[model samples]
Target chain A: MELFTPDFGLIFWMFLSFAVLFFILWKFAWPAITKMIDQRAELIDKGVEYAQQARQDLDQAQAKAEEVMQEARRQQADILREADRVKTQIIEEARGEARQAAAKELDQAKLQIDQARKEAEQNIRDEVSAFALNIAQKVVRNQMSDTKAQTQLVDSLLDEIEKKN
Target chain B: MKRLTLIALLLISTLVSMSFPAAASTKGEDHGGEEKIDPKEIIFEHLGDRYGWEVPFCHHKSIPLPIIVFGSDGLHIFSSARVEHGKEYVDGGKIFRIAAEGDFKGKIVEIVDGEETRPFDISITKNVFALILTVIVVCLVLLPLRCYYRRKGYKAPRRWLGAVEALTAFIYDGVIKSTLKDKASKFAPYLLTVFYFIFVMNLMGLMVVFPGGANLTGNIAVTLVLAILTFLVTNIFGTKHYWKEIFWPDVPLWLKFPLPIMPIIEIFGVFTKPAALTVRLFANMMGGHMIVIVLTLLIFIFAQMGMAVAGGTAVISTMFSIFMLLIDVLVSFIQAYVFTMLSTIFISLAQENPHKEHGAAEAKH
Candidate 1:
C-alpha cells in the first residue's frame, strides 16, 4: 500500500478552516460562555456572603451568651451582698434587744434593793427605841435588885454588839 | 477605414491561433521527426492506462502547467503535459514549484534511486482542485462576514452573529474547556482551530459531488498527520501528573511486586493511548473513503459487462452509492468529532496529576 500523504491542497483547506472558525467563534461563542462563568462566579460569591453572615450570627450569639453569663454573675454577687447585709442587721438587732432587756432588769432590781434597804433601816431603829424605853422603866422599878447579876448581863450584851458591828 | 482593417486582421489571427495546435517543447526525450501522438490519447495513456483508473480532469486552457509524476525516481518534476512528439506544454501563469514535497519538508529528505520506473501521470485531479476551491470559498464567504461586523460603523444583525456565536460556544463549552482543564482558554484558540479545521474539511468532503471528485478527508495521510499533531500537542503540554501516572502508577504492592515490569507496562500504556488516537482517526477516514470509492467503482465495473446487465447493476449500485453517500456525509461530521474528542481525552489524561489521587488514597490509608 502506498503511504498516504497530505498535500498543499489539504494544508490550505485546514488553515482556512482554522482561521475562519477561530474568528467566528471568538466573536460569537466566547462571550456567552464567559458570561455563564461570570454568573456562576457571582452565585458563588453570594453563597460565600451568606456563609459569612451565618458565621457573624454565630459570633453574635456567642457574645450574647457571654453577656448573659456576666449579668448572672453580677446578679449572684448582689444577692450574696444583700444576704450578708441582712444577716448582719439581724445579728445587730438581736444584740440591741439583749442590751435593752439587760438594762431594764438591772433598773428594776436596783429599785427593789433600795426599797428593801430603807425598810430594814426603819425596822431596826424602831426596835432599838422600844428596847431602850423598856430598859429605863425596868431600872426605876427595880432599883436595888442584884447589882452583880445585872453587871454580868451588861458585859454579855456588849460582846454581842461588838460582833454585830 | 484604417481602424476597421486592423480590427478585422486581429480577429482573423485569433481564429487561426485557435485552430492550430500549439507547438510544445519536450523535456526528458527528444522526438525530432516522428508522427505526432494525439494530445487526448497521451493524457488517457498517462493517467488512465497506467493508473487503471480515469477521472474527468480539466483546467484553464490558457495556462499550461507541468504534470506531476510519482515514480521510482521519487517525485519527478516534469515541465508540462505531453502534447506531441514527446513534447510537453507548461503553463506560465499557474505553475510554480515549491521546495516542500509531501508534508514533512525539512526533516525527511526524498531519496531518489535509479531503478525500473513505472511512470504514471496523475493530473491535478478535479477533486483536488475542488478541495482547494472549497477552502477558498469558506474563506471568501466567512472572512467578509466576519469583517463586515468588525468594521467600524457596521452593525450586523443579531442572527448572523448568533449563528457564529453558537459554534464558538459549542467549541468553548463542549471541546476546549471540557478538554483542557486549567488552561482551556489558553489552548482554546488551538482547539477551536482544530475543531473547525476538521469540521470544514469534513464538510468539504461531504460536498465532493458538487465540484470535487473525491473526499479529501478519505485520504489516510491527511488524517494521520492530524493525529500525529494531536499526539505531539498532548504529550508536549502534558502535566507532571501525566508522567507520574505512567511511570509510577498507584497500585497495590502485591500487584506491582514485579518491580520494573509493572512500571514498564504502565509506561507502555501511556504511549499506546495516543497511538490509538492516531490509528482510530486514520482508520475511520480511510474506511469511509474506501467504501465510497468502491461504490463508485461498481458503476464502472458493471458498465464493462453487457449493456442490459450494466443497466440493471448501475441502478442498484447507484442507489446503494447514494445511500452510502448520505451515510458518508454523517460520517464526516462524526469523524471530525471523534478526532477532536479523542484529542481532548488524550490531553486531559496527560495533564492529570497522578500524585493527587495517590495522596488522597494515602491519606485514607
Candidate 2:
C-alpha cells in the first residue's frame, strides 16, 4: 500500500473540525489564556520593579557606609593632627623655660663674682696704707738720730714727688 | 495604470476563450467493441493511473471510483474510473473501486452515437460516502465538546486552552508582535485561524490508518494555495520599512556600490522566503509519508526475491515501519508549527513601522 492521500471526504471533515475548533477556542479559550498571560506579565514587571528598588536601597546603604567611614577617617586624622600640635607646643614651652632658668643662674653667678673681686681689692688697699704709716714712723726716728742723713733723704724724696706731680 | 489595464485585458481575453466551447477530446470517449471488456477493467479504464513525480521515491495516483447519480430521468450511473497511458484498467493497481447506490436527483447527460442522451442515475462512490462519514464524525465529536464547555458555566480547561494559547502568544509575541509591533493584534484572529487550521490538518494527517488513507496536508495544491495567501497578505500589507529593508538596506560602502544587483537579489529573496515556506512544509509531510510507503513496499520486493529474504525483510520492514510512523507523527506537528510561525513572521514584517521609533525618539531628543 502507498502512503495516504487526501480525498474530498478528508477535506470535509477537516473543514468541519476547524470551524468548530475556531469557534470554541475563540469563545472560551482565548480570554482565559490571554488573561493569565497578562497576569503573569504584570507579576514579572512588579518583580523587576521590586528588584530595581532593592538595588537602589542597597546603593544608598553602600553610600551611607562610605560616608560614615570617611567621617571616621577625618576624625582620626584631626585627632592625630591635634595631638602633634600639642606635642610641638609643649616642647617649645619647656625649651623656653629651660633657657630662662639658665639665663637667671648665669646672672646670679656673675653678680657673686663681681662682689668677691671688689672685697679682695679693698683688703689690698688697707694693707698698703698700714705699711706706708709704719715706714714713715721709722724714717722719722732715723732722721732725728742722724739729722744730716735724714735731711738729705727727705729732700731727695720731696724733689722726686714734686717731679712726679 | 498601464499594467493594470493590460492585466484586465488579459483576464477578459482568457474568460472569452474559455466561453468558446471546443470539441471534446476523443481521448476521454468510450467506444464499444467486440472485445469482452471486464467490468473491473472498464472501471480502471475510467480512473487514471498513478504517476510518480519524484521517481523511485514519490508518486501521485488519483483513482476515480464509479458513482451512481440519481437523476430526474430515472437512475443514471456514472463511472468514476479514468485511464492512463492510453490503457483502460479499473483497479489501477492501487485504489479500490467502491460501489455506491443512492437516491440523488440530477439530470443524466450522456453521448451515444455522437449524439447527447439521458439515462437513469443511481450510483455514488464509496469515496463520497467516506467523505460524508468523516464530516459526520467531526461534527459529532466537536459540536458536543463545544456544548459541554459552554454548559459548564466555566471556561474550558486550562491545559486544553494552554496549547492553543501558547501557539497564539508565540505567534503574537515571538513573530507577529516583534515584526508588526502596533498592527499585530489586528491580524491576530487571522493568524490564529491559520495556525489552528494547519495544526488540525496536520493532526488529521496522522490518522491516515484509521479510515481510507487520506493525507490532506501532503497535497501540494493545498499547500500552494496557502502559500499564495501568505504571499498576497504579505504584499498587500507591506509597509515602507519592509520595502526599505529589502531593496535598500543600510549596508557599507563596498556592498552598497553594487546597488542594482543587490536590490534585485534582495527582491528575489522576498518571493523565495514564502515559496520556501510552502515547499518546505509540503515536501516534508509528503516525503515522510513516501518513506513509509517505500519501506512497506520493500517487503513485497523482498518476497519476490526469495522466501528467506522475504521473512527477514518483513521483520526489518515492520521495525522500520514502526520507526517511520513515529517520526511521521513528529514531522506532522513540527511542519505545522513551522508553517504557522513563518506565516506570522512574514505578516508581521509586512506591517512593521520603520520610522515610528525614530520619530518618537527625535521628539524626545
Candidate 3:
C-alpha cells in the first residue's frame, strides 16, 4: 500500500522534466534526424535511377554504333562490287578494240600482197613474151641469111602449118 | 569518448570523497557501539524517497535539497537540512521532523502538539534530483547536436551524434516503426524521449551511491506518471474505430445486447494496460535493487550471528552481490526496452482500424 501511494513531488518533477525534454526534442532533434535519413534515402534512390538510365543510354549508343558499322560495311561491299565490274568492263573494251584493229591491219596486208603478186606475174609474162619475140626475130634473121636453112625452117614450119590446117 | 572518460573520472572522485567521509564517521562511531544492521531499513531506505542524497556509509553528511510544501498556510519553502534526522526542529511557527516509528515513518512531516501533521510534501527528493540530472545529461548529449544538424540537414553522423543517431534510428525503425507503422514518425520524438529518460534513470539507479543512485524508475510515483502519459497519449490519438471497438466490440449479438458485457471488459482493458505498465516497471526495478541489498545484508546478518559464519558469509555474500549487480544491469536495459515497446504497441493498437479485419474477411470470402 505504501508503494502504491503516489508522491506528488516526484510526479510533478517527472512531468516537468518529461515535458521539457519532449518539447525540445520534438522541436530540434528528431525532425532533423528523420529528415536527414529520408533525404539520404531519396538521394541514394536518385543515384541508382540515374545510373540505370545511363546504362540504358550506353546500350542504345552501342546498338547505334553497330548499326552504322553494318551499313558502312554493306556500302563498302557494294562499292567494291561496282569497282570490280567497271574494271572488268574496261579490260574487255580494250581487248575488243585491239582485236578489231589487228583484224583490219591483217586484211589490208593480204590485199597488198595479192596486188603485188599480180603485178609481178604480169611483168614476168611481159618479159618472157619479149624474150620469146627476140628469140623469133633472131631465128628469122639467121634463116634469111641462110636460104637453105631458112627454107628448111620454112618447110618445117609450113609442114607443121599444113598439118595444122 | 573523452567526455565519457571525464564523467567516469568525476564519478570515481565523488565515490572516493564519499567513502573517506563515511569511513571517518564510521570509525568515530565504532568506539560508541556496533550498529545493528536492519535489512528492512536498508531495503526501504534505498527504495523510498529522500530529502537529501545520503553519502554512503556516512552519518551527518548528506547533500541536502530544497523542500517545498503546500498546506493550509499556503506554500512553505526551506532547505531540507533544516529538519534534523530523528529529531525535531522549530522554524518560525512550524516544527519539522523525520517520522521514525509509525505508518508515516521515514517521511518528513510537520509536528503540532506532538502529533504528526500532514503537509503536502512537494519537495525535490532523491528521485526528483535524479530526474533533473537525467534531463541535464540528455540535454548535454543532445543540444550540441543541433549545431551539426543545423549545418547539414542529413549527412553522416559522428561521435556522440552518431551514438544518438543510432539509438534514435533504432527506436524509429525497431520499436516505433514496427508498432505504429505509418504514424511512427509523428510520435517518434515522444517515444524517443521516453526511452532515453527511462534508460538513463535505470542505468543511474544501478550506480547505488551518492550523486548517482536514485531509484527514479522504481519509484511508483514516477512510473505512475509515465504510465499515465502513455495512457493519455493512446486515448487522445485513438481513432473512431478504436472507440467503436472498445464500446461496441464486434462480438456475438447476445453479448452486446444483454448488458454490454464485452464493452465493460474492453473499457476495463484500457486501464489495465497502463496499470500493468506501471506495476511491471515499478516492481521489476524495485525488486532488482532489493535483491542486491538483501544479498549484501547477508554479510551483516552472519556477522551478528557468529565470527566463523560471518567470515564465510562475507565471501558468499560478496559473490552473490556481484552476480545480482550483473543481473541488475541486464534487467535495467530489458525493463526500459519492454516499457517503450509496450507503450508504442498500446498507442498503435488504439489507432488500429477495427473495420480492417471484417473488410479482410469479406474480401477473402
Candidate topping DockQ: 3
User: Candidate 3's residue-wise lDDT over B180-264, tens digit each?
Assistant: 7779887877887888888888888889687577878889988999999999999999999889888887789889887889899
Query: Which regions of candidate 1 fall more than 4 Å away from where they truly are?
Result: A3-165, B1-161, B209-211, B253-259, B354-365
Worst 10 residues of 3 chain B by lDDT: B16-25
Model 2 segments beyond 4 Å from truth?
A1-165, B1-182, B210-212, B244-259, B356-365
Model 3: DockQ vs. true structure: 0.45
Give interface RMSD for all predictions. Answer: 7.2, 7.5, 1.6
* Per-residue error (Å), model 2, residue B3: 69
Share of native interface contacts recovered by each model: 0.14, 0.03, 0.73
Which tens-of-lDDT digit does each residue in B297-352 have in candidate 1?
A: 45444443545555555555555666777787787667777777777766666666
Winning candidate number (TM-score) = 3
Determine the iRMS, in angstroms, of model 1. 7.2
lDDT of 2 by residue, B15-48 (tens): 4323211111121123333233244332222121
Prediction-by-prediction clash tally: 6, 22, 0
Q: Candidate 2 versus the native: TM-score?
A: 0.46
In model 3, what lDDT does residue B111 have? 79
TM-score of each model, in listed order: 0.49, 0.46, 0.76
